[model samples]
Target: MEIDELTPAEARIWRAFARGDYVDFRTGPDDDPADGAAWGPERTVRARVLRTLLLDGPRASGEIPSLDLSGARITGGLHLQYATVELAVRLKNCWFEEVPRLYAARLWEINLSESVLPGLIAHAVRVDGVLRMTRARFTGLVRLAGAEVTGSLYLEGARIDAPDAEGPVLQLNQAALGADLWAPGLRARGPVRLTGASVTGTVHLKDAVLDAPGRTALDAQSLVVGSSVTAGCLDARGTLDFRGARVPGTLELTHARLSCPGGIALRATSCVIGELWLFGDGRIEGALRLRRARIDSLSLDPDLVPDEVYLNDLTYGALVPQHPAERRLQMLERDGDGYVPYSYEQLTAAYRRNGDDDAARRVQLAKLRRHRRTLPWYGRVWGRLQDAAVGYGFRPLRAGAWLLSLLAAGSVVYALAPPPALKPGEAPDFSPVFYTLDLLLPIISFGQETAFAPEGPYQWLSYALVLMGWLLASTVIAGVTRSVSRP
Candidate 1:
């Protein structure tokens, strides 16, 4: 298009593009023209004219020319599919009639700060510099799948509402970023996806509001981040998934309100992170998935625990706040996914890492008690015997007390009523202590059990003592063997 073919507003923007100057076309206060429909021709620049200026404008003499327009209404679609533009595009406080299409377009910096647009489609678009959409509002979908951003992408204070869209409201699946995804106050009505995305720096979602009730609000599966991904104070209504994600730094969710009710609230299965902080009195309304996740430091608050959790094979180096062993044990039991031994072992290990061997032993005992519930009736009965006599081999003092109590009772009863000698002609005189010891010892012999045979009630008591001895011995052996082999 020639200079004469451009409109008066387009002519002015074209002149400014050549000279590399910023143009403010608003005649009055900076107010949005309702849907960009009420704006006059003086403030409306057709998208074709801007595209021509970016692609076929006059050559620059010294500095690189840029297209920076503010407070102007953009009419028609600014389609730059597969095109190469070597300049910056800054359209601050502007309103668009049609969404900008930059599919597979290679460009420099692009800033749409405080602009109101229908949506954006820049999937597979390669950007050399920063892509900032600070405080911008989108009423439709913002697709940026497979985009390669050389610099950081900032979406602070931006609002993207496309609750009725077929896909995510802010689609950024598989995007590769050279720097951080710094969105501090982002608000999205529909789901915001970042599946398979890679960021070299941190992902800041602080105080962001993501609402997609009965669905996934943030689907960030397989996302790899170099630094921390902080979602502190975030208010999400649906699941915030991080399945198979790898974050080398902390994933902090302090003071976050995550609500998904009978569904999964925050799923981070198989995530490998430095620290996972879910503390600070946050309200977690649904289940949390930490199945097979490995973290260095897992900081949790007792009051912030969710009811249903799947923590099988989830290992952590340490648990912060150093809650009492009993409190931490309750957290492990909340794994409503049934009895997973690995969860107990992992929690015990976390306690042991801090030199709390006593707490670790308690956890082991609790594990046995929990396992008993999943066994058959006979197994459970045997388990109860071990617990009563030996505390599942975790408390040696309790085992000693049980042994002493049984020994004292047997010795007194045998001393009070001595059993008759079996072979009176050859049998030696039987000592009451020796007889009681012989009946109680399952393996060791004191030569008195065979020498004397009690008749009637005394015989019944002897048999009962012998059976009790065998049961106690077997249960103790099994519990001790398990504890020793596990450690």
Candidate 2:
């Protein structure tokens, strides 16, 4: 407990916190113009060595560089529960707006490397060891980056970890991730940089087994894991180099076993993800490129990408495919058969880019009869109605339902025939149209010229029983719309 020994005016506030020197820590101590706790050279000796270890409770390890306590104004909660201090508490260029609060402050193998931690609120901070924040400037909302304890939130060439572990990584690179930043099992040997840091949120690291034998590379560049992150699972099997990372949401990678080299590139260009399950104990041999990813919904969730993986320039949703077979089930297993056949030539190339080719070929024949049997799908619905009756020439609803069901069944057989009395003048018959017009009756009704008609005979059998009940209800509604328009 002897390291707090500096005094030539506290070594100029510890070399202005080793040179980050921001200065104006809210003004006023009036340089001993007679007490107000006398402050001067830019502030931060970590608030007077943490207010002399919270009023002298645990200051023996090295007594903190000899007490001048730099601009002095540190506040409460410096409770170092187990007390065993060794030294290396160099709050680099620290200027925390008066060390507001930090509960279980157990900085075990401490080294807070290069700090300038703006408005920190160390909620559950129990770094049982290393917390080296490489190149810090962490303004406000650090919210413990979703505190879970165990250690290893390191940040290699770090610029930002949490401006809003859920709402604001602003400063361009937006943000969003309410929780789950759990560090897997965390035995971190090295390799964990938020490369070129612009992280909005989600850097989960599920099952985190970073053994980094000699550490080749593990950068998470241009990182903008936004879209308010819902689940979280970036399991890095070793060399994860998210080329230009931008995962908008659900990127489970199911059993995430990526051994990386050229694997997981999600080819960023504002890559907007949401539903990308990529199933089973993962293994991206080299290229999972997703060229310019924006997949709104592509869940291969069943086993997690083993329907025989392929991927490239992917286009499953979020619109962009004009029909080269929409191309996104990109080989989730082909030859050995991890099942494909969502036919109608891939639902007519995803309904010609989602216009709805006969409802995407009836949901690709109802998901290919739920698992195939040589999908006849009614002979592909009579070959798509005979290719819409011969290459989309058009049938006008089957020639207007076969000429309105043969004119409503020949007007119900000529209104049940047998009433041909225009005989009084005789010339009216005109010999039934000269010589037997083949017993003519396809329909020729012209009988309403009555100055005194309806003379009797039950009024012509009540006008032929109301014209045979209106041609039998128009031939039973055109034969029930041609039996529900079959296919």
Candidate 3:
């Protein structure tokens, strides 16, 4: 297409592209036309004309060819599938007639900020520079699966109102970005898929709102990020899945509100995260799942309690702001999976590592109490007895107290009524204290018990004392042995 053969608007844009000048034709921000019907010739450009200039544009010696346009209404399909363009294309504040197709295309930088488009498709495309679409609005699907970007992909302040279709509204599955995938202040009305995507830098989703009721809002399964995924203040209405993700850096969702009523609000099952920080006063309306997740550290707000959390086999190496077991042990009891011993053990080990032996012992006591509920009726009765007598081996001081109480009670009853001396004059002299002591210590028989045989009610009291002695001794030994066997 020669200069004279081109339309006047196209000729002007051609001269600007040759000089690498940015062409803005709209009068003001309010001059945005939904269609080119009301637009002047200066504000209209065919998609083919833009494509032709991008591919065969005149480049000055030692100067890079560029095409930067603003406020232009594109009038046809901008299909760049499998086409290689070396210039940086910036089409800001433009209204596209339809979504562009850049499937498997090798391109340089692409910036479509503040544009209104049906959607975008750049599947399997390779972009040498950054792909930016900040503040752009997409009414349909935005596919970027298998894309390889050398620089970051920015979608800040973008509003995508793509309702549920055949797949996710914003698809970046299996894409590889060399730098960050920054999407702060992003608003999406459907599912945003990032499954199997790899980002070398952080994935920022601060102040984003994602709404996909009764379905997954953000599905980043198997996502491998080199740095953190910070989604502070994110409002996720549906399930946000990060299962199988390997984020060596922290996955910080501080102050993020999650709501998926009657379903899991956030699922990070089997994820290997360096830290999972949820330390703010965030609201969670549904279940939180971390089953089999292994986090190096966790920063949890003591007041931020989830109603239903499945922590079966979930292990964290350390806890931020670690407190005593009284304040922290309630979290282990809140597991909805019902009696996962691993959760208690993991917490116990964490407390021990902090050199808080008192906290560790308290956790052990809680574990036994939780386990007792799963036993049979008879076993539960025995468990209750041991709990009251010695706190399931965690409270050794209670055992001593119970023994002293029983000994004092037995001595008082015997001292009030003297026992009859056996064999008349041949028996030893009666001593109430020694006689009571002899009955209680079943293993050693003192001569006072053998000689002074009690009569009537005193004899029955002696038998009761002997039985109680054996029971207390057995329970004490069992509890002590349990404490010694572990740790």
Model number with the top lDDT: 1
Best by TM-score: 3
- Residue 251 error, candidate 1, Å: 1.6
User: Model 2, range 67-184, lDDT digits (tens) per residue?
Assistant: 2232233333334433434333434333344434444454544443344444355544455545544444454444443232343444443344341244332121121223223343
**Clash pairs (backbone) in predicted model 3:** none
Lowest summed lDDT window (length 10), candidate 2: 432-441
Candidate 1 stretches greater than 4 Å from native:
4-7, 26-36, 411-435, 443-456
lDDT of 3 by residue, 453-480 (tens): 7788878888998987887777778888
Q: Residue pairs in steric clash, candidate 1?
A: none
Per residue, candidate 1 scores C-alpha lDDT tens digits across 15-82 of 88877899987666747644567778888888888888889987558756899998888989999999
What's the distance in Å from true for residue 8, model 1? 3.8
Which should have the higher TM-score, number 2 or number 3? 3
Q: Residue 96 error for model 2, in Å?
A: 19
